[model samples]
Target: MERYMSLLSPGDQPPALLGHEDIQAKLRKWITRRASGSEVSNSALIISLWGTEGAGKKTQLAHLGHYFNEPMLFVDMTKVPEEEREGPDALDNVFREAAIQQALPVLCGFLLQEDSEAMRNRKRELLDRLKTMSGIVFVLSEQPCQPIDLRSRIDLELEIPPLEGEKRSDAWRTLAAAYEVDESVDWGILASRFVFSPGQMSNAMRTARTLSEWRQEEGKSGPIRWSDMVEACYKQLNHHLDAKAKRLTPKKRWEDLVLPEAQTKKLRHACNHIQYKHTVYGLWGFDKKLSYGTGVSLLFSGPPGTGKTMAAEVVAKELDMEIYKIDLSQIISKYIGETEKNLREIFDEAEKSCAILFFDEADALFGKRSEVKDSHDKNANTEVAFLLQKIEEYGEYRLWRRTICKT
Candidate 1:
């Protein structure tokens, strides 16, 4: 089989590739791994670069656009209207020109925007069609949407998380070099505290500089302090989560609550898990032994308003993080499986935010299974089972459930 480099233009006047070095290196490694000894087939190699919006995915791809010559069109799906992108013929229309040139298709935005049933079906069809193409296909999406049976169409896939570790630290230093940062400020601490992308970090720096000037004495700011940068980072993070779940800033603490010594001690232990997670899981190396990150979930069972909810708030206060209450009844719908889907979406977001999830009236959903009298009973039982699985799958979340009935 030819090298993965074979997919690029062979002409002397090859187009220019513009993404970052790491991404380009990752792509090269993926291609090398695939082209090592695999048999050549009519099937195309579909690579999906997935990440959240504004995480530099589309920009990186666009930069690489100059490298691909004729037949390999780098389509920016965002330019396509929401209606056109979701239509059934979206894929066929984009690929028609390439198809006529007998060139491989590089379909973008299979999951870049809000997804619908029609878009999902079209994406599924596109994956099937890629199987018969004789060249490599590159797909750019926020999240990869692979068809069940057509999963083989994907040769390699990559997901970009928030700019982390050295990359994040580098971004901070880059900002500090240009800004009036004080010697007291620690770039490493700020980088560790905020899992921000390059775009977010840039915005945060701009915000910090603006805030520094606003609070400046006689319009003259002292060297940008650590406090200013962190404050800006919090501002960026706080406003984003409100769109997903209710943002809670708890004033309550353990000292404010009157509970039994035993109960209070248990609550203290929950806070310990959240506090020591980075150290135990990351620094102490216990994270490797565990399948998932250390997540501690507690079921606050008792009467209504008997400080059950308050305990969760106290823990959130202890951790200095926010708590979000999601009513189980509100998430449960008449439609079958909708309840499970809603729960999954909530848990997924909570996993990332590291916020305390206090699901009030959980017994309504997590109650004991009943004998199957009808399909409704069976579906309810299935939902309960899925809830259990999802709880285990949420590796990096702290969950708190309250119930009226003791189970």
Candidate 2:
């Protein structure tokens, strides 16, 4: 073990993978099969690496480049000028440059926000050329474009999930060891509370260290404070949740909460469900019993300032996630069918975020229904019923840490 650790030293070799064993193995196998004449997985060479913004596509590609001892060409498609991105010749030139540079595993990022068929077709052209000329190709997108963008030509599709459980812990440990920070830092707490990707964690460490250094004089080498790490982790995930809802940093704890003991206990248990649902449902084989509604959806009923919002924040803080108060004005619509559409957009975003979804003023959505005598009444009932069904069905998509906080 000591010898292996020594070999892992950055001086001896490039950075160790730490947690991406499966990705490394698949990437290496594909590179080998593509290089050699050996029959491969349907002779497919185009691989798509996609996830959220900071889910570590570029970093993973770097690791793959290091593993294969090859140069990588990273192209952020968003940076491609609007005129250049629209034209086929621009992309064609970029591919010619990558080939001339003898770059392997070209990483290109495409944002669905600027989604255009011309852009997608240009990407397709590059992908086909790369498969024939380059070592491998990686297409990164904000959404799941594996089937649509890459189509059936995907030799390997690596969707880099946000680091959770042991992977998160491994990331903390790996960066901590590299930084040589105090070993006493609570990595388990960080792992539990932050749904950071490997790249985000790397940025968090750098930010933490810089903050620590700025707080003290040089050569003193003060420890990276726990608060610094917490703040840094929070900042890394700040940009995504702003449009849909406001992000909260809970200054309150269970001690600060003033709810009745029974209610508090129920809230605590619900938070636990968010933290360890995978263990109870998957490891203990409890998932075999029931199908839908594995997520904990509870109604926190009380008057205003009854600690409902704070409890949501506490759960998010305790579980190392962000809390977003869904904007009710945008969600609850007067127009028919638009309510469901808005709710779907919010839920869809929340599913990816894995944050505590605090739907405040939710009584507006869930009200006592009378006999449906009119179209308005029927539409209201339908909207309420649709939300309930979607909330119940969120569990089918592996939302282990997604807690639905209703107020």
lDDT of 2 by residue, 170-193 (tens): 778888876746655677657655
Candidate number achieving the greatest TM-score relative to the actual structure:
2
Compare the candidates by lDDT and give the number of the best one: 1
| Local distance difference test scores for all models | 0.65, 0.64
Q: Estimate each model's TM-score.
A: 0.57, 0.68
Q: Give the per-residue lDDT of model 1 (tens digit) for 369-407.
A: 999999999999999998878777665444556556456
Model 2 score (lDDT): 0.64
Indicate the worst ten consecutive residues by lDDT in candidate 1. Answer: 1-10
Model 2 TM-score, all chains together:
0.68
Give me the displacement of residue 296 in model 2, in angstroms.
Answer: 3.9
